[model samples]
Target: KYVPIENAKYTLTERFVDEEGNEISPSVVKGTDYEEGSEYDVTGDAKVIDGYYLKETSNTTGKFGKGDMTATFTYAKLGKIIPVDPEGNPIPDAPTPQYPNNPTDPGKTTPDQPVPEIPGYRPEVPSVTPTDPGKDTPVKYVPIENAKYTLTERFVDEEGNEISPSVVKGTDYEEGSEYDVTGDAKVIDGYYLKETSNTTGKFGKGDMTATFTYAKLGKIIPVDPEGNPIPDAPTPQYPNDPTDPGKTTPDQPVPEIPGYRPEVPSVTPTDPGKDTPVKYVPIENAKYTLTE
Candidate 1:
């Protein structure tokens, strides 16, 4: 609940902390009351500290009744007063929003144009490696190799109203199955363990929650602009190219190093918790110990 202060003004002052815990001072603004005890949901640009604005929900609360929120501002002994309005979203009137004019071209007053779609959603194969003639574009995107992820566990719904462990595997989603993700159930995996809910109970039998096992499935090779996979892509059978002209070779046999991992030619997880990953194991009478 909020109690508005008309005729009188409210303001709060505080120092700012940098991401590294350093304190910044000198430039500052104050916040006033929209009213006390009033619940409000929020949107708009994230609050900024040290030139960075906070985006997204830092927290959430209900809106006070049904009226739209407002803003009002007074200049500190340092500057000018800013008027009020819902600047694209609902924020209170007391804590006026201040935007520092773009300093790179502060003298020129025109605005920047907009490019509606991002590269991922653009038409054509967005350059695998940037070839931008303009200074604004990056030169190229470094391709990270041997990057791999494994499946782990699943968290699903409970049967009806009971709380028991009976969940399905995330492999279900890998093969393109319709599953739940909201409230009623969850689908957890190793590489990306999640415990979300699906209100409609789309995972499985009404109420069943359980721990899931994990395994390596496969890797993704970055495809080239000419419909071919990039030569250095981490796909099976494409390793050790001395010439560098890129070859589409056949799958190489697992090397004779008895217990070395011959399963995946691509990179595998190096950390499985507190222990360092063992790269190879020595075979002995069919049993082996991974090199410690």
Candidate 2:
């Protein structure tokens, strides 16, 4: 009884094996079968080997159902991985993959191929290059020729203290690219970003430094006649004249303490170009002398 199996199909599996013949889990193609002239697409599933890159090999595509055919892809080992911070600062502790899996061979050392995912950091694709052919003995793998940029966010208080290690906002521009400074600044707690430099201009050009200036909340300190801070002084308020609908009146009477009279009956607050103005109030009391 020599009856051929109807539509009998042979299994076509693509196995991605490392240099040591160990199969990479991600590289393994799901088991599929095809009859003669039946189409089998591995285009989407084919992945570049890790720690190695695709080379200019002769074989890329072919017909299916050639009797359990095996397609082997060639890859070059990676030599280096140069990781940089968002500000283009080099991260020295970045992982480096070994060449020929050897530690002693300096010529074979290359940067790791995988870009590390650090929270609040944006990583760029790494540049790759083959080992120098001029070396005493040519290496088998390619190395990271240029370091990739990983942008990190920055945040600080008015006093230059670190408030947050990163910014929640994102910028689309790359290093050396012109950035617009006209956009509104990100809001921070208890502080306002001062426009010390050009607020509406291109960055990386003349007087176009992207500098952020944070100003703390305004304060009015009441001092004694001896120029010492007074205890329990009334806090000054800005735009204090609530009666005026326009809120243009900046004069607000100094708060009355049981024993003190203001040197001036009313103090006018000064506008420091902030959302709110600060007013300094000096009070004179016959019971206790107060100074500015």
Root-mean-square deviation (CA) per prediction: 24.5, 18.6
Expressed as tens digits, the lDDT of each residue in 15-126 for candidate 2 is 5545555555344434457666665555444454445543322223456554554454434455544455555555544444333332433223343334543322445554
Write the residue-wise lDDT of candidate 1 on 192-280 in tens digits: 21223332223221122233222222233333334444443334322322332112123433223433333344343222211111123
Give the TM-score of each candidate: 0.16, 0.33
Winner by TM-score:
2
Query: What local distance difference test score does each model get?
Result: 0.29, 0.43
- Candidate 1: stretches off by over 4 Å: 1-237, 240-247, 259-292
Candidate 2 has an lDDT of 0.43
